[model samples]
Target: MVRPDKVEAVAEIAENFRGASASVVTEYRGLTMAQLTTLRRSLGDGATYRVAKNTLVKRAAEDAGVEGLDSMLVGPTAITFITGEPVDAAKALREFARTNQGLVIKGGFMEGRALSVDEVNRLADLESREVLLSKMAGAMKGTMAKAAGLFAAPASQVARLAQALADKRAEEGGAAPAAEAAPESDTDSAS
Candidate 1:
C-alpha cells in the first residue's frame, strides 16, 4: 500500500508533467552536492531539476499522458522538467555535461513525443526563440524589399527610356523631320 505522502508526491510530479514543455532524464551518479547545485542554478528558473524515484516518475508520466518514458528512467536518474523554453533547458544540460563527465543524458520527451539523446543534443544546439524570430523577420523584410524593387523596375526602365529619348533629341538640335510640322499648308490661291 502506498502512503498518502507518496500519493501527494506523485500528484505533484504529475502536475509538473502536465505543465512541462519538455523533460530530460539524466544519470547523475557521481555528482557532488556543489556540482548539483551549480547545475541546477545554471538551468535557471524555467527548468525544474528534481531527483525523484523512478517508479513515482513513471507513474506521474503515465498519468500525464506521456508514454515510452519508462525505458529512460534508469539508474540514478534525475529529471529536468522544462517549463518556459525546452531549448534553453537542453542547452543548460548540454553545457553542464560538457564540463562534467559524470552527468550523462539518457533521453527526453518533447511535446509528448519520445526523443533520443542525439535528438536532445540537436535541440540544444538550436538558437533561442528571439534569434529565430529575428531571422524570420529579416527574411520577410528582404522578400518585401525585393518585391518592391520588382514592382518599380518597369516604371524605372520607362523613365530612363524617356530621358534617353529627350537627351538624344536635345543633342540632335530638334525633332526628326518626320516629327516636324506637316509641310506647311500650300495655299496657292494668290498665284
Candidate 2:
C-alpha cells in the first residue's frame, strides 16, 4: 500500500513531466545550498530544477508517457523541467555545471526523443532560439534588399541613359531634328 503523500507526489511529478516541454536530468551529489540556489536562479523562470526520488521519478516518467529517463534516474538525481525554450535552459544548466563542478548533466529528453549526455552538451552549444531567429531575419532582410536593388538596376540604367541622351541632344541644339533638317536632294531618303 502506497502512502497518500507519496501518491500525491507522484501525481505532481507526473504532471510536471507532462507539462514540461523538455527535461534534463542531473546528479546533485555534492552541491552546496548556495550552489543550488545559484543554479536555480540562473535557470530562472524557464526551468525548474528539483530533486526527486528515483523510484518516484520512474513512476512519474512512466505515468507521464516519457521515456529514456529510467537509466539516468540513479544516484541522487535532480531534474530540470524546461517549460520555455529548451536551448535557454540547456545553456543555463551547462553554464552552471561548468562553474559548479558538483552538478553533472546525466542526460535529457525533448519531444519524445532521448538525448545522451553529449547530446545535451551539444544542445547547450546551440545559440538561443531568439538569437538564431534574429540572425535569420537579418539574413533574409539583406537578401530582399539585394533583390530589390537588382530588380531596379536595369530601370535605373535605362533612366540614366535616357537622361544622358536628352542632355546631349539639348547641348547640340534646342530645335527638333525635323525642324532643323531641310528638304534636300543629297543624302536624303525622303527626298
Candidate 3:
C-alpha cells in the first residue's frame, strides 16, 4: 500500500511531466549547494528542476503518457521540465554542463521520441525558430529578386535597340541632301 505522501509526490511529478514540452534527465552528483542554486537560477522560470526518485519518476512518466524514459532514471537524477521552447531548454542544459563538470546530461525526450545525449546536444546547436524563419524568408526574397531581374533584361535590351534605330534614322534624314548632290556630280562627270 502506498502512503498518502508518496501518492502526492507521484501526483506532483505527473503534473510536471504533463506540463513540460520537453524533459532532460541529468546527473547532478558532487555538486555543491551554491552550484546547484546557481544552476537552478540559470534555468530561469520557464524550466522546473526537481530531484525525484527513479521509481516515482517512472510512475509519473507512465502516467503522463511518456514512454521509454525509464533508462534515464539513474544515479542522482534531476529532471529539467521545460514549458517553453524545447531547443532553448536543451541549449541551457548543454551550456550549464559545459561549465559545471558535475552536471552531466543523460538523455532527453521531445515530441514523444526519446533522444540520446548527443541528439540533445545537436538540438541545442540548431538556430531558434525566429532565426530559422527569417533565413527562409531572406532566401525566398533573394530568389524572387533574381527572377525579376531575369525577366527585365530582355525589355531593357529592346529599349536600347529602339533608341539606336531612331538615332540612325535621324542621322540619315539630316544627310539626305548631301547624298543627292553627290549623285548629280557623278551624272555631270559622266555627261
Candidate 4:
C-alpha cells in the first residue's frame, strides 16, 4: 500500500536520477543546517544537493536503473546530482569535504560506470573539459604549423639553390655560355 505522496516522491527522485549526468552520494551525519546550506551554495548552479531517506533513494535508484549505489545508502545520506561538468562538481565536493569534515564522499556514478571513492577523487583532480579541449587544440595547431613548415622547406631550398647557382655563374662571367649554347636555326641552313 503506497501513499500517493510517497509514490510522487519516488517518481521525483527517479526523475532526478534520470536527468542527472552524474550523481555522488555522501553522508552528512554531523553537519548542521547552516553548513548544509553553505555546502549547497558551494556546489554551484550545476548541481543539486538533496537529502532523502535511504529507502526512497534506493527505490529511486532502482527505478532509474542506476546500480552500484546500494552499499552507499547508509546513515544520513545526501546526494549531489550534477547536471553540468562532473569534474567541477567532484572538485567542489572534495574541497568542501576537506574543510567540512562532516561531509564524507562515499562514491559516485558517471559515464555509465560506478565510481569508487578514490575514483571520485581522481575525477576531481581532472581539469575541466574546456581546458583539456583548448590544450588539445593548441597541440593540434602546433602540429599543423610544423606540417606547413615541412611542406614549404623543400620548395624554399630548391629556390635558394637555383639562386645560388645563378649568382655563382654570374660571379664567374659565365653568362656568355647561355648565348653560345643557343640552338642554330634550321631555316638558315636550308636557305
Q: Which number leads on lDDT?
A: 4
Each model's backbone clash number:
0, 0, 0, 0
Write one digit per residue (lDDT tens) for candidate 3, span 88-158: 77888889899999999999888888889999899899987789999999999999999999999999999
- Candidate 3 at residue 52, lDDT? 85
Model 3 lDDT at residue 14: 91
For candidate 3, give the lDDT of residue 163: 96
Better of 1 and 3 by lDDT: 1
Per-model TM-score, in order, reads 0.87, 0.86, 0.84, 0.88
1-191 per-residue lDDT for model 2 (tens digits): 98999899899999999999999999998999888998999998989999999999999999999988989998999999999999999999999888888899999989998789999999999998989999999999999999999999999999999999989889777666656565443448754
In candidate 2, which residue ranges exceed 4 Å CA deviation? 167-191
Tens-place lDDT digits, model 4, residues 1-191? 98999888889989999999999999998999999999999999999999999999999989999999989899999999999999999999999999989999999888777789999999999999999999999999999999999999999999999999989978666766655555344445666
A best-first ranking of the candidates according to their lDDT comes to 4, 2, 1, 3
**What C-alpha lDDT values do all the predictions have?**
0.91, 0.91, 0.89, 0.92
Whole-structure CA lDDT of model 1: 0.91
Candidate 2 lDDT score at position 182: 53
Error of 2 at 133 (Å): 2.1
Residue pairs clashing in model 4 are none
lDDT by residue for model 1 (1-191), tens: 88999899899999988998899999999999999999999999999999989999999998899888888998888999999888988999999999999899999999769999999999999999989999999999999999999999999999999999989988775665544444432334333
